[model samples]
Target: MIYLLSDLDFSLPLSNPVVVFSLVLFIILFAPILFNKIKVPHIIGLILAGMIVGPYGLNLLLRDSSIVLFGTVGLLYIMFTAGLEIDLEEFRKNRITSLVFGLFTFLLPIGLGSVAVYYVLNFSWPTAILVASMFATHTLLAYPIASKYGINRIRSVTLTIGGTIITDILALLVLAAVIGTTRGDIDATFWVQLAISTLVFGAIIFFVFPLIARWFFKKFEDAVSQYIFVLAMVFLGAFLAELAGLEHIIGAFLAGLALNRFIPHSSALMNRIEFVGNAFFIPFFLISVGMLIDFSVLFKGLGALKVAAVMTVLGVLTKYLAALLTQKTFRLSPLERGMIYGLSTARVGATLAIVLVGYNIIIGETPTGEPIRLLNEDVLNGTIIMILITCTISSFVVERTAQQLALQEENVPRDEGDSNERILISLAYPDTVTELIDFGMMLKPRHSNVPVYALNIISDESDNGKTKTIAKKMMDKAVHHAAATEQTILPLTRFDVNVSNGIIYTLKEQNITDLIIGLHRSANQHNFLGATADSILRHTSETIFIYKSVQPFNTLKRLVVVVTIKAELEPGFAHWFSKLTTIAKEAGLPIDFFATPETIKELQDQQAAQKAEVKISCHAFSNWDDFLIFSREVKKDDLLVIVSSRKDHVSYQPSLEKLPYYLSNYFGSNSFIMLYPQQVERGIKMDDVQFVDGSLAETISDSVAQVSKAGRLWKRLFRKV
Candidate 1:
């Protein structure tokens, strides 16, 4: 039998979604790797890849509806994440500096760009102003690079991020005004309508959206629903912004700001949002941006090339001048100035948006009565080239300058008085993994290189292949949750005959000084500590924190810290106090310290010495009994922290053992933590101390006491009558 062989078709049709999607996915997957191997920025590689597979190149893909849909989503995602990821504390501290930079960056570009476009390129008045505004807008294309280098917390970076909001708003406002004027609607009525709509939109998004979101998040605990709710808010904000005759990006950024406090930077929800954006939406946007380029125009004649060169040079130079002026005024270092310039130079998202808006406006007619486009094809093509060039330069400069800035920071000693400390969270239940990680993050030392440890211990008897696999998967979930907060979690899996022993062994091996474990009810009714947690607490000499969370940590209204007399004299007081302050600051709540006068004085001294930012209010208590009275003052939303000592320690007391029971009875509806501070060992030998198995004796005593109390109360009531 003769076999008929046909030549395989090389062309793929764009009508088939599968074929187009597969090709794009292949490009997205390999482009970065190929570029990385050649020492090129992955962003540039992605854009180039898009061009190669674009309609103008091999004609393999079509610029269909999917591009527009994903492109818009990607643009909004970038803006939303920018607003969400900002260091709010730092932003507040440098608000004035940001305002100054915003004005400088905005004004400088408008002035310089207008002159270049009007005099050099000889564009008309309206056209010149519109194009000038394009130069005024810059995307945070280099921000990820700065964040990667761990210098994102610096004042300069914070200011740059803040300035981005101001400049983009002003630029887009100019675009809106120009569009209105071109459409013959620039009158008193137009101005009034615009102003009123904008104010109403702001009120709805900033005030209404947050209220709804707070209620939604509180009502729903499902992660998938939460993620979808956030997406809905983003699109809703975009839709409202368009309705108000403003850009959708403005709405997206505002939506981020609105929900910023609800979703902590280190939260699992924030992580999921960023992951989805970076992995899919953002890449699609970059590819779509690339497809807009037509390289044939660059080689066809000198006109397009001239326009591109002029736009690129003017854009970079104007942004550089803005940075230089801001640096001089602020007395910043050259490295800082370079970083500011780099971060503010890239023209991409906003630039494209403005150019597209301008390109669509019909301004005047030619001699033949044909409509004369406000932004010509040459200007559009030129802007695309400018985006590619500036993006490349911005990325390179940011990488180099960020490295140098980080090095300078390393050489300079920090005066913040915070020490490097690692926090380890023990995972018991899969459902509570994210909550536990978030707790660790709230207490983690900021701007430090220490990584958080998440330990999952399995008993040796249950350490079969399937059990180990399940444990690994659970640990992976914890890791992903921590990763969202931009935190590094060293996941540890250990096996021992006892779960607590396994955790303790891993802690020692990891050299962890701070341990956090979830609180669980013991099988024995009288035992406050679960068997596993109690064992670890009794055996470990390090600082231990037992957390029982009833609500989200961010919702806490107050942090009531109960400290025993002389508790501040312990070896771990200063360290634990520092961590406490960190949590208070991260929670943005006031701390009420219930301690003796001397202990309060000591804590105050430590706070003043460390220059801590948390606000602490001292409430005097003579002894541990006074803590019982404060239970009435604790609200449902308050977080109670009892600072206790180990058995036989200097600060240890009989009442300390009953503290957990009292809290369980009085503050059952609240979240509470029992922190055992580290103690200094005495000269007594280990064998001299008697270890008692209180499990049996405590159970017997509890039963006998209940029976006696009931009989005595019943006899008294009956006999007296």
Candidate 2:
């Protein structure tokens, strides 16, 4: 062999960070090009390269320690970022989806994985746990894939993210319990201690951290949120992890989450962290895994071959099986189900890290907890073989499968729109509408079933006009808040003669439902804010949510509607109520309705001529005392809505501020949330509404079809991901 760097002995420098760092960079930079051309996985390429230069192959470097430290760092970064992105409120709202998928992904994989390890390969129970845990993780790569498929803003991502977190958490717990048992430390006290510690940590991070960070950012936005401060939080998380005998990665994740409210530059922070981790640190991690691989055992051992094959089948099959559980639960198509199956396939890095740690304890050449089967003379050889086989094979399967899906070569029918809980908000702002901008942001909350849109409508005069600058500033500001749970803001330049007409016209144009605004009374007392704002209230024919300047908006607590046995709601009562209930339930919100005696009787009367067929689990109440009582007990942030269709013109007797006067006073500091109801105008046909992953699927399909006649997954990975 040529002596490029082959003169170095493997035993001499196992922990040589510099050499490991140098080699991984070369491979990572080139792996995509080389692997894509060969139709194999780049991960495999890295592994092959690892074996060639490792102690087992050329003996160029020593194998005293492991490359997993590099992987651990990357894993920590990934986990922390994952935590930062998780929508907690949505998890509460869509707990059914989260709990189901989360549990499915957890159990399905372990069961299948154990069968592969024990039933097929006949490993010990401890080893089975290790194998099973690997299957439990879904790929973080799914984020990129979901983004590529244009479903990132939908419920699909929400379920996937929530499920993945639970999967990893359970995997860790299982690993802990198993490892404890393997090490003779298994006890009820140990499990109890573990549970208590996790709960305490989670509570502090969830409730306390958000409050503190919110306070810090509010009080000292600039001074308290420096880079040094970020570092301190990171250290705090990692140090706590150490003290608590938990993985430092958990600390990193929790730390990022706690500080999400405080970090005004979240996207920028992500970009910077990604730049360092991906461009600089991560390559070293990959290369280190590669450099220590053992080619001899990888090539020679049929046992290793069998394990890889067995695992591949189990891993893919388990996820597919998990997908099946949801088939009856939700009326999703097979393709949608399959897409989720593929989407949830988390990669092997984290799994490998934890397993290897356990493996080192009981016995192993590689990272499985049992007596070492491939150790002694060919330890490194065996390790390299497994890595090369597993990474390459799994990567190839996922990529090719996804590519086929993108191509439409598969016989599956295509669907329209994203039906999931994710929402994208495009906000429209007036030139001087700064008062309720914050309140406006609340209407387009990150945690809502529908994320609000902050759109500024421009006349599109100058390409570099003031509208463009303002729109960008507003978008940047909303993104900076981290308050948008499922929210996305897209601001653009469009022209209109008067701002209000422009606003109404634009509202109709964008396919968005909610319009959040601060109803500022005119200084001149002209009786209205904007003729269009006033007109929008009356004739807009859409749901208009009004925000305010007097109070900061809180998450909507109670949703109340006043109902009458009107002819408009005759046929569509159940359907309309069903829609409202789903939205509220999905948001984990409560809803209340005030009805007349006839209306309450109407709600209960099956023979009543219901128009919309709106089904609801909650009953209607006719008592005035009960309505007042409910209103009295309403949370300060509760939204009391009257389903009025026509816009409210100024009342001569009562001032604009005084309309819902008595009830508004009872609520104290909270702003009274007002919404002009949506009329069942122009009978809603089935095709009119796009339902699916936050409607992004249809949006993408529509946007693309409009732009071009035809498109497929031609270079789909590149196109989508």
Candidate 3:
């Protein structure tokens, strides 16, 4: 049993699981690193590695059951991620364009390919149609490259994903019908049954699954449990799709769509999903694709070579034609056309599924008593080779196109001041840490390099040993939670005489632009602003957000922003506006702004200038006399954002003093934010002041005082409105 390596048999194909696993892991680790030096896309490297080590090459590994299982999961994960990351709003806007592209991609290939397959390959009608259908179908194998480049939100990418689902459905339908015809099951009743089952399956995936996922997420807070629940839902959808006569990928995609709204693109859950799939499952799938290639068939005869060449040419050409037609019809850019073609050209998942189904159907036998299958060995081998070629072209083209697009978009202008914006979250209550971190993340700008800070301040009088241990645990949890979302949270703990002083000190030291703290849970009518929040607000000049949530941010239905008249004049107006709109866009929620006519006009102008994709509806509301009237406009599930102000600020009102008391009494069950925007610092540095124009400076100061006085007068004059 203690045999040495020299004494063991050196097999051509490795059978030991440990050896096979080590070889695959090594391939996964080094293939990308090795290929990066040569400037080749790592996706190509993985596939090539698989081919070199597969049974057809050096025979170091076989495509065993374990490989097949992992590969299948990887394929489904790719489809799921495609759906999960798609912009739902964009998808809706381009549904018609997607349909046009889908029809072109599907019909062009099948129509031309059938003729080529029949005459060039000399296949019969049934077999020819099946083979041609393979040309119409393609997998999203190159999507990971596009995702890595961070261009998934672009219009061209959204259109490709939309078209992908459309064409795949049509392609799978064709496979079902062709198989039915071959099996003598293509009767009227069979079509009716298929239609009914497909509808039922769609309803279950799109309608029922979301409800389940929503409830499950709200009830369970454990990260591991939530991840496992999501995976279970994905496979359940896949299994049900199979029972309904559709491919598992279709179900996996639909499952993603159903849960899309629940998972924010930048949340911890989305990061985990993408991380696992990209790091492990997706690589496994890519390797298995290369293992399907068989070069020996090409050397055995010319028939297989001819078939492979024809299939590859038709597949690539037809897909290009489809992309070109879509470009012309939609007036898309040349770069976008190239992107579509690259994404739609790869043929692997559905192609293999259809070919295997055809190859397994036996119709007759030769005089030698050999069974004559629907798809011969030559076609099977040709399909495998075609997979290799198309995948290579797809990976290379997508990589180049994605790089170009990312560069082009980077040159476009974005918000200016946000490049330096950093957010700090003060963690006190154990239950509010996750929501606080999530809120901070949503408020931060996308693709920002600034790190989020989570702080826990321990009282100096408390026993250092026990208190420090507790604070350390809390900080560690905060860091781990943020890391799941691919974000780095700097965890800090300090001993201070006052809790608010600790937060204020950290804010100044870190140059934090925004401070987010949870509203006190035990505050009564007399103790409303909570000692800590009040103290921090009175001491700091940065933007401060006091939040309390009765439900998860993702589960909220809408964001209702109550803008005070002149609130837009605050120093931090643009910063807070940008944050709210970003949250709306990421959560895929519409926003309703209740403000005075002047404020509404200003908001509309800002929204148009930013060209934000959020659905915004502005309503005229200047009812300062009774702030409670606005409470009727808010639903229990809505996120209410009351734009309050400090007493020294221009937007401050007498009615705002009573806002906390009113909210606790009337809207106690709803999630709300008391947002206080940054005000101008009061102290002016004497060194920076100049006496170049004494009269001019004095006149400007007098004019500012007059404006402040006039603003108060206007508020009084229109108090009843």
Best by lDDT: 3
1-721 per-residue lDDT for model 3 (tens digits): 5568776655978987788898999999899899889987898899988999998988898999999999999999998888889988888889899999999999999999999999988888888888989999988999999999999878898899888888888888888888889888788988788889999999999889977886888788787898898889889999999989889998898888888888899898898899889889999998898888878999989989999999999999999999999999999999999899999999888899988988998998999999999888989999999999999899899999999999998887866776778889998877788899899888876777767889998977678798888888788878888888888898888779979889988988998888899988797678877988988887888889999988888877789999887776566776677778988988878899999877787788778877777889999888777778767888876899998887755577787878877887988888999898875563422233333443444322222234433334334323522
Question: Per-prediction TM-score, please?
Answer: 0.79, 0.58, 0.89
* Clash count list over all predictions: 1, 56, 0
Q: Which ten residues in a row have the lowest lDDT in candidate 1?
A: 696-705
lDDT of 1 by residue, 95-180 (tens): 99999999999999988888889998899877888899988999887776786676876888889878887898899888878787
For model 2, the stretches where C-alpha displacement exceeds 4 angstroms are 1-73, 80-143, 152-183, 205-350, 362-517, 521-545, 549-668, 671-673, 677-721
- Local distance difference test scores for all models: 0.79, 0.52, 0.85
TM-score of 2: 0.58
Worst 10 residues of 3 by lDDT: 696-705
RMSD of each: 10.3, 13.0, 5.0
Cα miss at 432, model 1 (Å)? 4.7
The reply for model 1, stretches above 4 Å from the true place, is 1-13, 187-193, 214-223, 262-268, 298-306, 406-434, 441-512, 522-541, 554-567, 582-638, 644-662, 682-721
Q: List the residue pairs that clash in candidate 1.
A: 266-485
- Sorting all predicted structures by TM-score, with the top scorer first, yields 3, 1, 2
The total of clashing pairs for model 2 equals: 56
